[model samples]
Target: MNRTMVTAVNTLGQLHKQVDLIGHNLANAETAGYKSREASFADLMAQQINNYSSAGSEVGRQSPLGIRQSPGARISQTAMLSKQGSLKTTGRPLDIAFTKENQYLKVRVQEDGTSQIRFTRNGELDIVNAGDQWVLATKDGHLVLDENDQVITFSGKVEEVKMIQPGTLEATMDNGQNIAFRLGVIALNKPQYLEQMGNTLLGLPDGADNNINQIYSDLNGARRQEISLQQGVLEASNVDIGKEMTDLMASQRSIQFQSRSITLADQMMGLVNGIR
Candidate 1:
């Protein structure tokens, strides 16, 4: 009805979105290698109108001499926090964790009968028997990509595996042969462009590589970036429970305040209509 009510209603919708985001982060608090998301708000377009034509009485006033009408605020960005989480020792040979911030392991996810490359920090790895060979994969069955961005497949039986060095996995085959697979990792050059797919995977928007810097490695070393990973350990989720709760409470308060404003505006309109 009025600008006050309209603005309040609009802002309330955005605040609810922030609350939903906070809840999502809290729900994933125990998910390994999960990163927290932070939402930011930006004010909508505002109209500045001169309420008074006379500046005679407002000569010494320091504030602006106009009424600003805004349609409230909206969630501008929900940036992913890439801070490193605490390392947890799982004692499992396949459980791995990245030791550096902004570093993510590469995996191939199948969608719509095609394989797409995605990045993730979750390191719960497993070896599965493919049709003809054994392949390294995530717990969700996404194929693990090696230094060449190719599927890490072994021709023989992998009896055991361990991390002998950073980003390198040493696998002992059943025939007493030791094969080393260097995992592929990418440093997030522009994580803001990443979209969150399901199964703890983060993917590029529309499969664009312009947001990433190529840094695959060979047996010798990486071309531009180096990665560090340790076996038998997993990275805890970076979500801070206490902070999320606090944010949720604050958002609820704001919603309540905005709702009250809308109610007051409605009452004022009713009173004006009923003027005697």
Candidate 2:
């Protein structure tokens, strides 16, 4: 295949990936705490046309240039947007809104009937049935843990969970952030390292060695305060619908234009072949 065709193919692939990301963002526009991701690309290396200057004895070399085709472009990265999502009020005590500065909540979830912990910024929590017991779960339905390091499962309609005050929640900076309540708090060495387990909850990645006991810490050294939870509110996705729509249009047009260029190139080559 021609070098131009190769470049065109890669460009089209990039466009397709970009469109998919935009569609995903739009689909989750109403999702609580959904963070949109953007695709990034880099230019492929092309052959140097001439050696006008050189450090050695190759100054002003006039030899025929050799073709050095690029390996082709690809989606280099998919960076997650860390911008604060909008806050919405739900008037339900279990609903929580994470502030911009110190966003993220820690929770444990069941993996193959076993439990693991992870952190997320989304604060949507609810109750669900598990093994004949109603358990307090994250909005996505992961079990919530109590002071005893046991999954806090409730049965049937139970009283609302005790609302902890902002003042009561404490933060200790370390390998993982340590969050404290009067009764108990879990210490996370690297909250960001926790893997996403869907439904606004996260779990430890495989091969991780996270212990429940590490979450508690009595040594109150240089630590900041933890984010306090409000009873009746949930955080909405931070995605700007208008901006996303605009980006989507731009990506669509780019793909169309690039595709047309490829078609034109093919037609030009076909015409040349017929002339001989």
Candidate 3:
């Protein structure tokens, strides 16, 4: 195939990937605690041409300009934006929002008969009875954890629950007992390393050496207290609808231009073949 066609094909492929990413951001615009991702493009390796004249070579010296032919462009990385989203108040005691960045709540999930810890920014929680124990859990039934990495559970029925402070919860049990527990607000050292597990939950990537216990320990040892929680509110998605729409239009135009370039290259090849 011609070099123009090859470059156009590669460019089109990258554009397609970018468009897909933009679409994904738009689709999750209203999702709670959803972080938007931006696709980064980089030029491919370029063919370098040496300039003998510029190098002061004695033989066959020509123009001093150095020429380079870039192969095309590609999506190099998809970085998640860490910008904080606006908080919406729901007036529900179980709903919570982080006032600081890079903080998340820890939850325990059971998958395939094994329980694993995951993190999330979505704090819309509910109370459920699990084997005669009342536990604070997410809507999907994952048990929320406390500061000690243990599931937040009550022995008896929870009559009333209130947020005494940002991270402290006071619960009144049916058996005339009141208990106070600190909510687990973990500050991630590197939030970008978290992989999206569906429903706004994030988990460590497969084969990652870091676990929930290790991360919690690190946060405690480092004395990192940059994060604070807000009760009765939830964080909205960071996606900007207008920006995503503009990017979609730009990517569509680029794709169309590359498609035209490929068609023109094919037509030029046909003309060359017809020449006597």
Which ten residues in a row are the worst by lDDT in model 1? 215-224
Residue range 1-276, candidate 1, lDDT tens digits:
698998999999999999999999999999988999999999999899988868797888888888787889999999999889999998999999988887888899998999899888999999999988999999889999987889999998899998777788899999999999888877776677788886368987774655355432232364424667788999999999999999999999999999999999999999999999
Q: All candidates' TM-scores?
A: 0.90, 0.71, 0.85
Candidate 3: which pairs clash? none
**Model 2 over residues 213-242: C-alpha lDDT tens digits?**
342232122332553445567778767889
Candidate 3 at 51: error in angstroms? Answer: 7.7
The top-ranked prediction according to lDDT is 1
What TM-score would you give candidate 1 relative to the actual structure?
0.90
| Candidate order, TM-score descending | 1, 3, 2
Give the Å error, residue 33, model 2: 1.3
Residue-level lDDT of model 3, residues 20-128, one tens digit each, is: 8898898889888888999999999988786544445445646446678887999988887878999999998888888777788888999789998888888888889
Cα lDDT, all candidates: 0.87, 0.62, 0.82
Task: Please state the error at residue 22 of candidate 1 in Å.
Answer: 0.6
Count steric clashes of candidate 2.
Answer: 8
Model 2 worst lDDT window (10 residues): 215-224
Select the stronger candidate by lDDT from 1 and 3.
1
